[model samples]
Target: MPDNSSYLVVPSSVLWLLGFAVVSISILIIATMVLRARRLRSGMHAAGATEPTGSLLPEFEKNGQSAAASLVQWSPETLRHILAKELPDAQVIVVSNREPYIHNRKGDDIQLVVPASGLVSALEPITRACAGTWIAYGGGSADRLVVDENDRVEVPPDSPSYTLRRVWLSEEEQQGYYLGFANEGLWPLCHIAFTRPIFRASDWESYEAVNRKFADTVVAEARNERPIVLVQDYHFALLPRMIRERLPEAIIITFWHIPWPNSEVFSICPWREKILEGLLGSSIVGFHTQFHCNNFIDSVDRFLESRIEREDSAISYGGQISLVHAYPISIEWPPAHLGKLPDVAQCRRRIREKFGLAEDVKLCVGVERLDYTKGILDRFDALDELLKLHPEWIGKVALLQIAAPSRGTLPAYQQLYEECLHRADDINQRYGREGYTPVLMVTEHYSQVQVYEIYRAADVCMVTSLHDGMNLVAKEFVAARDDEQGVLLLSMFAGASKELLEALIVNPYDAATMGDALLQALTMSQEEQRQRMQRMREIVRDNNVYRWAGSMLLDAARLRKRVAVDRAVGAAPAAPGNVISLLDRKRVAAL
Candidate 1:
């Protein structure tokens, strides 16, 4: 009876105290979980570690994991071992239009700037890994200040490894080959971006001269040794053939960085046949997506008399076969602590202060080169529509458009730049407040650290490329979001959209739809943002620039083996006294 009375007499105050304790413990558990997740996220970013999301190439899998480890996790030594195993005794030589490190005169001292390019990010590691040579156009003002008599220097200056062999291009050569032929001709011709390609005979001649120059340099570097020559992008469409002519024993692999239009569209190029013949000199030719590969193959089939092996995706002509393949390029994941650096907060603060943005105002950032293909004008249109539809976000959201000037000499690019400024001005005039402009357009070139700071500070990153090979800015933004916060509004036209499915994909042409998407991105909950960003970060971290390079090299190696076998079976004649081919034959025989 005493125990029963004691139980029944339990005080309401005691019950309230117990309930409070239970509630506090629950909150503590949730908070701990949230903190633990954040710590794990930070650690993964720092380590460039990612949970495997299947494999990009199932054939290159060992125990359900890709042989090519995440760039963050894989060392240069690891990559070297892989290259040795894949193509033993073969030296790698990379050819590209853009140099990895450009030396410029910063006041009196020589300053090296790494240009913004997916090619540099992808191939530079391969060169470092294998101690290979990188042949590129020396367009920097002070390029000669660093190079030796051989036009060669070890890079990057901070931690030098591998050789950088620069091919000097005169201002006129650069203007005609790069700005005229590459940008005005091959660029627009391949992109399907509605920009009419301007093909000039002088431009074509300059392009040819540049290719020959690069070929001569590669031949000198190889010097009686048959090396693996990787020709990059449209700037060197004729480079593969030119190199092949010089070193017939060389294993040439050309990777076209832009999209290949349908045969109908590509027929507009007066030099289409020559371009096809030049590309066909490669043992392998790669594109960013399968659609591009198919387009290239179809174009060759339609325009040329080459025997198309549809099953193998190979074009047979000139006593050689060139295989067409897809290799989607990506960005190098920044050091895990990049966003967590002590200076990042200061950088973010500086950017905010520079733009006069308030603490509560959310940032929507767009980083792009001022070019017609980048859809800078379309992005502004979407922003204008966004403010009109959602009046509530008028002062709450601000767009920071960082338009890096590109090809300023080109009339189309110049017009695009002027149009971008005009559109941004019009938007600001309509929706801007006294202290807040809806769009803060920054046209100056920003250092990598500055760009990373901008990426880290943004609540949303808009990649509205009208058409692109693989818009790497989308991947870069994903890599910079170490806090697992931010939304990605990626253009459906970009090749990255195929891989980054978690992003809010929209057509840059649809302003109303994009405006609604902007609203959705702005209003997306913290949990939703974390989920989307986490998935994208994992994808980008796993399929990084190293993986892209490794995958391409692996395919090239496979094609090399196949070609050698085909030659052995009398598909083509092996060059007499070609020790390289002999070694390859012996290796194939042993296998």
Candidate 2:
């Protein structure tokens, strides 16, 4: 008892020193923890671990350099390597309505024709880089000629790289699915360009059937492993849910390659809720702009009972969270052989001769599919107004409107084509001279080389879309202008208008304003044209198609990783019950 009391009763100075040392040590430990925690959070945020507050645009950094900033120097090999790093054991599969290469019957010989598609140009490199499968509709006459027994062929015949899996649909299926539901219903529904959307029960049934068929093919191709499936456009809006039902673990990404109207506008569809549910099945849904992304999220919030994460731009439904992001698509930059001024000049000469135009005449070129959305009629009206306003340049300026025929079977498209012809005729009749036509309408397909030549030769390139998601024609024109000599008369409605601010943007709906823009483009100084084209070329060259695909892929991978982490932490509950409630409580407590 005496020894214990002596041990307990220490010296006052010694006790004070011990107390000071303990307090100092505790403070040091706490300070170290605070600093370490800050560093950890900063590192996680840099690595895209923390959810973004607004506009969840992917910021990819490599070698301490922004990937997007360095995209101009990156080759397809670099993009492929990045994909391999991001998805180690996963195979990439692309699903779209249009095939990159079409083996069509040209006379007796079957030839491969790469259709004029921005989607093809953008995603083809990704497929080639990953050596993946691109599943598309086999609409070409000789599409079956090139495919192996598995209905798969290595595309871009001369430079075979990736597998092209063609999905053949019956005539009725194509009619109902593509022409009926997709073009008539979803196309008009999405684009708020004053076109009425037509929805029919038969078309809906056909659309569902085609979606199921595609999903089956995708699943069969996926087989044992869960592959990353990238569904393209509105044609397969229902495919995501179908694929999700079959393979819940698969990483599905759907990119809507058009504008998304507001929720009120979108609610006009009879099966809007079903469409929303189907879209939410994806791990991620992408749009071309932030406005479109917001529209999609708002539409989902309005139509479905889902937890909308406004900060992250994600929707949590049925125990899963799907990210919604904007990935503005673009064209391949610095088009091959664009710098061959001698060749371009020769092609221009040939084009002028074929079209019966003088070499000195200022050529305004507009290239687009013959669709109402392209504002072809509006372009003609502008041309008519251009001639009327600028009487001096009646015979000096001509617009070479090369409209590739599209969906000719549809009445709307047919009427559009007819109206364009009538307008062109009226303009030519009113303003044409012996050697010059105000508008030269070429209703036929042109090869890529020819289109590039047109782009290089033109004094002005016009993209007058009523509404579009990244109209690549503008970018293509920009890429082809190696000399930086052409003016871009772009419509304010196009997605490209946001990036190509140097272009003389006009409202296509206003004919008089568009006429003035055309005149301004025609009368622009050579130096001004060069400056504008240079800036636009830089923009296109920097934000090329490769960067677009890479950004989407990186974001999709991050979303999948986040979902996996949530599942591991039991934050993603399968059913709405006590488990979810407990997880929510834990999350709130942790926060």
Candidate 3:
């Protein structure tokens, strides 16, 4: 008791020193945090992650005019104001599932890294060159930014002209909708694997809920002006209807990247009607080929009992009031047209040497992503049949199948990979010399240059997809063949096959047809191969990806102009102006 007070009370000099030390530590921490924040902002700026603000459009003046008034009632003035500022002039937002870059951890922080793939080439410059807005979710490597529930990764000001937004999905929402329903249920079914489709009531509900959430996100993000919303693929089919309901004036354009099966096959799915109605909500629907467009129209007609207004260039749903057209999406070939480098020749030589082929041996190549619909097994069977039917060509020629690894997460894909391995082994064992394996199969993806090498060296290019939207690989192969000594034996079922009639078309399921076609292609004269390949190059070169994108945008813009004119003339009474005409929030909420 006597010494307690003295012990508790420190000397004034000691107390002062302790206080100074604490303040110095506090200052250092604050300084370090400030420096860290500045670095983060710089990083975000470099990665093109800044939020878009103010008028995004320069051509249109901000004088309280609405861009979408002709299409729909511009009720919300804020949406109109934002659209006047954000569209057609500022950076155009190209929304996708994944962000452009991947992020890595650095001692409680994260760093962004770009993916080395064809996607990078496809998206990077397209996004960077645009002076419009880009609204995309933080996918892949960019997911690291949302490490904390409360913390938000700031988008820096000096970032690229693109405005990338986040549609961060909760864990439950992702598992139930994305993994469970979208992948397991719709993905397999859409690809025409009816037996494999895993349907669940709960999954359907989750998917609907997620669709509603996505609609909410788009409605919240989109301006009320004429925002050209180019929605991509089947994953967001429901989004079109949602967007149409919310932002009816927005010019919504959708492109289906996958194959559209005929009503006979497409009708197998329980969600067929829902999918069709969802797609019809868009102003324009694009398909890779005429057959796919026809299939879509046929499906809508049969399933929904809907009338179709068929025109020479386009087809319109009678009741839905949406247009469907074939765009035949393609790759950019002008870069390749610039001139071949010396490395291309060297690359071809290197690929031939690496594959351990005799200088005179003919190479028949088929490159594809390792998916069930790609007909990997059937192609192998056809190859086996060819080798068995004609023993003379076994050692003389080889089948080089480049099955690129994709969707390995799916059990069906894993099983297909295993089947491929087994078949490759069986073929080699059945028809192999002391040092020569008859079938030269590789189960890995090649670099773009490597792919170019295969295309150049290949005597015959084979695209045997059971179902494919538009096999760009077929076009790529044709484009790279500067020598024009490549015979393309393509599948009739593929959407590209209709466009590439010059190629020797065969049914993938019909073994006799495929075998006969492959053998004929192998024996075809160099002149014939060159002639066929030249025609294909002409078709692809004329209808490149640039043309595809430009055509869609121009078409939609033109349609919007007509609608605008009609609105001005009072011919379009559907879209009445004034917010008061719109159903109140409470009434809308009830619906």
* Top-TM-score structure, candidate number: 2
lDDT tens readout by residue for model 3, 250-354: 777788878777788777677878878888778778776655677888888788755455432233342235667666666665444325434445655776789
Q: Give per-residue CA lDDT, model 1, range 303-329, as digits (tens).
A: 998777654466667666676766677
Candidate achieving the largest lDDT: 2
Which runs of model 3 end up more than 4 angstroms from their true locations? Answer: 1-92, 98-137, 142-166, 170-175, 192-195, 220-224, 303-307, 312-320, 335-344, 573-591
lDDT of each: 0.79, 0.80, 0.64
Minimum summed lDDT over a 10-residue window in model 3 is located at 49-58
| Ten-residue stretch with the least lDDT total in model 1 | 51-60
Which runs in model 1 stand beyond 4 Å of their true positions?
Answer: 1-77, 334-340, 343-347, 560-591
Instruction: Give the better candidate number (1 or 3) by TM-score.
Output: 1
Model 2 deviation from the true structure expressed as Cα RMSD, one decimal place? 10.1
Q: For candidate 1, give the lDDT.
A: 0.79
Question: TM per model?
Answer: 0.83, 0.86, 0.73
Q: What local lDDT score does residue 458 receive in model 1, on the 0 to 100 scale?
A: 88
Give lDDT: candidate 3, residue 285.
80
lDDT of 2 by residue, 28-119 (tens): 99999989976664443322222232233222223433333343454576577667787667788999999998888999999778888778
